[model samples]
Target: MSWPRKPLFGSIRARLLLLLLGGLGTLMLALFLLLDFSIDRQIFGRLDATLLGRARGVVVLLESHPRDDAWQELHELVPEYATGGHTDFVQIWDAAGSTLLSSASNAGNNLQRPPAPVPANAPLFYDLRLPDGHRGRAVGLRFAMPGRADEAVLVVAEEREQVDQLERRVHVALVMGVVGMGLLAALLSVLAVRGGLRPLLAFAAGTGPDGAPRVEPLPVARMPSELRPFADALNAAFARLQAALGRERRFARDVAHELRTPLAETRMAVELATRGAPSAQVLAGALASIDRMQRCIDGLLALSRYEAGIEQAQVEPLELVDLLRRSLALAATPAGKREVTLAASLPDECWVMSDPALLERIVDNLLLNAAEYAPADSTVQLALITSDEGCTLRLGNAAPQLAPDDVERLGERFWRKSAAREASQHGGLGLALAGTLAGLLGLRLHFALEHGVLWAELGPLRPIALPESPAS
Candidate 1:
């Protein structure tokens, strides 16, 4: 099957690649610019120094020889200045600003002169076009001749084609280097991002061959620290889901088991009626069987609804004493039929925040269960004990046949003390339904057995104070 397409920009891998390359590209561009500037500065500084030295040498030649001979000696001393197709050029001016001597390379063409006068001690370097129309660097200075009182200005220049060629070559190399490094960095970033996300991919694929989630918990020790908390949360969620599934399976099995006998009895009653048994007795037997089946079905439905969160508690302030008294009164007939006495010690007005209907069901179930199970002459004792933290309603009765271990199983569905007790009107769902309802109302329902007495404690229900009335 084809998978759904995801948006291009929504991929985390794409976003990370974009960020890594964008940042590194910027850094590389900056590095290229800086290196270009430094290399250019160093190359030109050396050229300027060399040109200044040549200008100094021209000054020394003019000082040592007479004015007439110095011009002739210049050609022999610096032969490059006199050669044809040469790269070097030199010129000198007298005190009267007239050209005293010129290199043969000039060929009657003049070099570009500076607008400002040359300094006596330091040479001035500048860029200019030479006589042959090539870009060149020049250095000019003023110096005193030996016999004359006036100083002469000398300018020396050289063609810069070689220097320009070298600079271009260096720039091309730098561009190539930056581009290569950027490409390498991009490749490495892709590898690192994929490797870093491998664990997450593995975690997402933690399923069985049938594509169901595995019940086993993930190995937290092998996981990266950054993902451990996420792994732990998934493990907890899976555990809860597994437990809910197990409970549902058991419930389904128990429901089928409980309904089987009633259905069989109903079929037997109808068969007896067909065989000419007394019509009234057959009808009554069938009705009783149908009623038992209905009770079991209704109880199962109620438990399922509560567990599935279909029923929500409507909470309000309720007087606990009044609700308890009503539940006890309703349970009196059942207790009297069994010859079991019912007694209670409650506070005057114990106000509590609880769902009225849900709490009433819980109290009624506790009272009925106690009364039905207590010995004929024994009393079912119920007491409301209040404390600073909360109030607890304890209901206890004689349970001579029950063991301590049985107390833990008190709220299980369809659990009876004996098969004979199954003949009673209760399908053994009273305590289970009560416990489920109490949980929905955020109340605790606990059971304990002590010295042949079974105690059911329902709550740590904190008391709510009543609103004070306005004075008339």
Candidate 2:
């Protein structure tokens, strides 16, 4: 079944980073707001204290002088005394509650400071609404004159509208800063992710990442240190791949070269046999040659497919005894002409996993090679034994002793023990093809020379349960 494909960024990186940044920005903005509020509170607190102190001092001066010029000078001093970003206005009142003096902004404005029961020494700041209907922080202080029966209170206040406006400006600036930084961070993250993926691109560009001989190695030093280990691993993998491909390439070339001589000779012999007045003996010989070429062509095609990784396809269970019985049946005809007896040693119900066609081909090649090389009237035996690991299939023939090197090189294409034997049909590529197919199917194929007998086996059997008949 096919799955839906998504866009690269939307499916992978962009969404991940956006979610990450969104979380980070939210946390950062919360902290920024908290800190901004704390600082604003401290700053405004200090401004309130300074304005209250100046009001207290004004009340003492107004009670001592009770004059217009002196009160006006006291208000002028406030503008100079107040801290940066703070403004002040003052209004002086007589004992009879008349406004004696006031600043320009407070002209004809009377602020009613509601009476509270507190200590005479306690001068407090409170929120008061003036006659103009505006809010301000008002500090009121009452003092008694030395020679008068009445008491005068000097009140001073500053408009608090600017504090609220400052808060709004701060909030806007903070939002803009967070948005700007988030954009910059996301851009850098994209660049960083791309830079890290560059080495993977280089590794993918090679001809084959697995075992192919033609694969080239990349320069490891040019890559980042974080990616160096992966590059080195790929280089090692390519080395193994190159070796395997080299073997396969050589096998193909050698098979073609070996088959060409017999094919060309067969064609020539047929041409001569078909000409006028040819003997029956010559015709029979030509027919044999043609048969040999046909067998070689068919074997080579099967071997090529096996070598090219076609064995990865699923194979059904093949009864081991049935497979061997069929192979011996076919090989018996050829063996009898050469005075060789064929035999099979196997259980009645042994089963295995394999492509029956290819398994049959493997068995035919092994038996044909053994029959040709075995002594006359000798038994060319094919044995199948059940074991703990799997089934063991062995084919043995009476032959001369094989050297250790010959056993090691037995399945190499075009390799033979003797020069004269190399020219024979049984020598060059048959065993190599059998071995190749066995390997592709994950089976072990090998040769051993035991006491002047050469043996080829295609197992350790993979066991399976046989199906039961529906009725006896």
Candidate 3:
């Protein structure tokens, strides 16, 4: 099935920018709130001091004069108190809570008053709404006239619109300043993230897919310290992929060369049959040629599927003894045709953990190779040995015609001994397939030429009972 391609949210720059936005925005909000609180505390604190200072001054004036005419005398001393935009009102309450003196025309008619003040306590400051419809602040204090034994309550209040207006102006400026800072931070975050990721971008740009493998490394020296390790790992992966691709290309050429032989023979067979030579023998030869082509195609398919790394192996616990017996039984007919004796020294219960179908292919290929290559009237030996370290299976056949050099190239694709090059059905892929399957099943294979004999050993299968080592 095909799907639409979508750009991933997998960019380092976008992630970094989002992270900075969240973090910086949170910090700015907290700082703005703290600034607002500090400003309110300081402004209100100064207002309280001013109110209390005026009240204290009025109390001193009252102590030096008589109560009946004190308000008039205070107005004469400070004429601005009689009428002004930022005027203060002073009220003195006697023991009975009756007004003794007032800055306004009438006593107890200005604003809502507070509880009588105590001399020992701190001054009480609060908001007030005057009868004249002005909003202001008030401070209440307790005092005693010099000649009187009775304590009196004194309250002083003044309009606060001017101070409040100043505070509102400062608040607007602070909000604008913080908002501007946030915008600046967002812009900087984009530039910083782009600048930081430049090395990675260069690395991507340098490594374009031109369909050829090359030993090119990412420029790790130009990247930041944080990305150097990742670049190093990427370079190592590129080297491995290049090697794998090289092997695949070589194998593809070998397969093409191997297929050409049977194709040419089949073409000739078809030509002969069309030229008045379509006898049973001629037709049979063509059929045989077709069969050889089919086998070659099948082998190529198996090898390609194995190399492509697509198939999921269905694994199970398998007994190797049964698999070996079945494989030898299949190879017995060919061995008997050449008068070769097939012998095995397998244990009663040789167990292994592997995919059953794949294991069968491995065993069949091993037995077939031994049967096909053994000398006439010779003994083909299949032996299995197990120890604490690992297990080994050795398949050896007497081969008087086999040379030392050919043993080394045993598992290579389409490689065959010069003496056996004329065989049409065998493509020399049997041992190669066995080696590939063994490696896939976590086993190992080695080939050697002993005294007038070819030895192929497959070993180190993961133990069925013993724990397998964890793959790195």
Model 2 alpha-carbon drift over 4 Å, by segment: 1-41, 52-87, 92-155, 158-248, 270-275, 311-314, 465-472
In order of appearance, the predictions have TM-scores of 0.82, 0.64, 0.73
For each candidate, the alpha-carbon lDDT, in order, equals: 0.86, 0.70, 0.78
Candidate 3 positional error at 136, Å: 5.2
Give per-residue CA lDDT, model 2, range 396-468, as digits (tens).
9887746756788877766766777744655356788888777766789988888888888778758887778
Residue-level lDDT of model 1, residues 189-219, one tens digit each, is: 8898898778877867763446565689989
Backbone clash count, each prediction separately? 0, 6, 0
lDDT of 2: 0.70
lDDT of 2 at 70: 56
- Pick by TM-score: which candidate is best? 1
Rank ordering of all candidates by TM-score, starting from the highest: 1, 3, 2
Question: Distance (Å) between predicted and true CA of 30, model 3?
Answer: 4.0
